[model samples]
Target: MKNVVITGTSRGIGLELVKLFAEEDFNILALSRNAEPVSSIELDNVSAFSFDLGTEVDLKKASDFVENEWNGKVDILIHNAGAFLNKPFQETALEEFRRIYEVNVFGLIGLTQQLMPFMDSSSHIVSISSMGGVQGSMKFAGLSAYSSSKAAIITLTELLAEEYKESGPVFNVLALGAVQTEMLAEAFPGLEAPLSAAEMASYIKNFSLTGSKFYNGKLLQVSNSTP
Candidate 1:
């Protein structure tokens, strides 16, 4: 079975992705800040652990698990963890802005670096971004820190794909629109999203499995709505 590692598995799209992968019988490492939700499922093919992208110790733990348990082989690595902040740019403190980048950008960089050694050419690295991050896309007020950090990952994905073009492990990013996730609900209360978390997760799962063959260092605008 292919080994997959997913971040932000505690809820929403991340949680749905874990279930989809488990149903497909893939060996999965589900990392989230709260491991209880995933751990309670008790799937033999799934392992749940508390992970913080900003914490070096957590990163080491994930690296060690891949090294010792999966034998240093990861077929898919999904960077889905994100930190959301809905505040006016002027009111957002430096520390708060930095925290957003820490999780959405720096944390992703650190984790990808840590696990890249275990991934081969056949491996796929999918980073989840937002529509707001795309250039000339619809912009939302009070998401300056969040959206800008997401944009960083899109460029980073393209760069990694070029740098490792000969070595393999395809890199791609998905810039998503609004989905009915807790994060979305919290960020924009009372606004109903056109798609559900499970719906989006299914698309992401399918893409992660096959999109690498057709695309690399590319950004797919996976948004049907203008959020």
Candidate 2:
């Protein structure tokens, strides 16, 4: 069976990804801050791990779980954990900016590094980015930290792809448009998103499993341009 590790599986796109992949019979290592949502599902192929991206202890525990249980061989790794800070540049405090980076950037790198031993040449690493970070898009006022962090994800993915070009695992990032999720709701109140979390999850599933066969280090943007 193919082994898949996904972060931020408590809800939103992460939750949906777990459900979708479960249907395809993949062994799922679901990581979330709260394990209740995933544990309630009660699937034999799915295991829930409670963790916080900003917590070093939690990250170490998660890596330990993967190393021991998964035999250090993962087929796919999805980085979906993120923090949002919707404050104007001047209003955004240094601590808040650091918090965002801790989860979106540092923690992501730390976790990925820990899990590298469990990945083979056929493994794929996918990070969910945002359109806010993509160039040529109109910048919003209150997303300085969040957008910049996502932009960092894109660059990081590209660099990893280059560094691992002759190696085995593939790296890619999806610069998603507004998806109707709690994160989007919190970031942009009352604005309806053109895409749903389930929809995005489906796209991510297909891409994670097959897109690597054709593309690597590509920042594929998905949006309806309704904003």
Off by over 4 Å in 1: none
Per-residue lDDT of model 2, residues 65-140, tens digit only: 8778887688999999889988889987899999999999998998888888887678999999999999878688
TM-score of each: 0.99, 0.97
Q: Please, what is the whole-model Cα lDDT of each candidate in the order they appear?
A: 0.96, 0.90
Q: Pick the candidate with the highest lDDT.
A: 1
lDDT of 1 by residue, 38-137 (tens): 9999999999888999999999899999999999899999999999999999999999999999999999999999999999899999999999999999
| Candidate 2 lDDT | 0.90
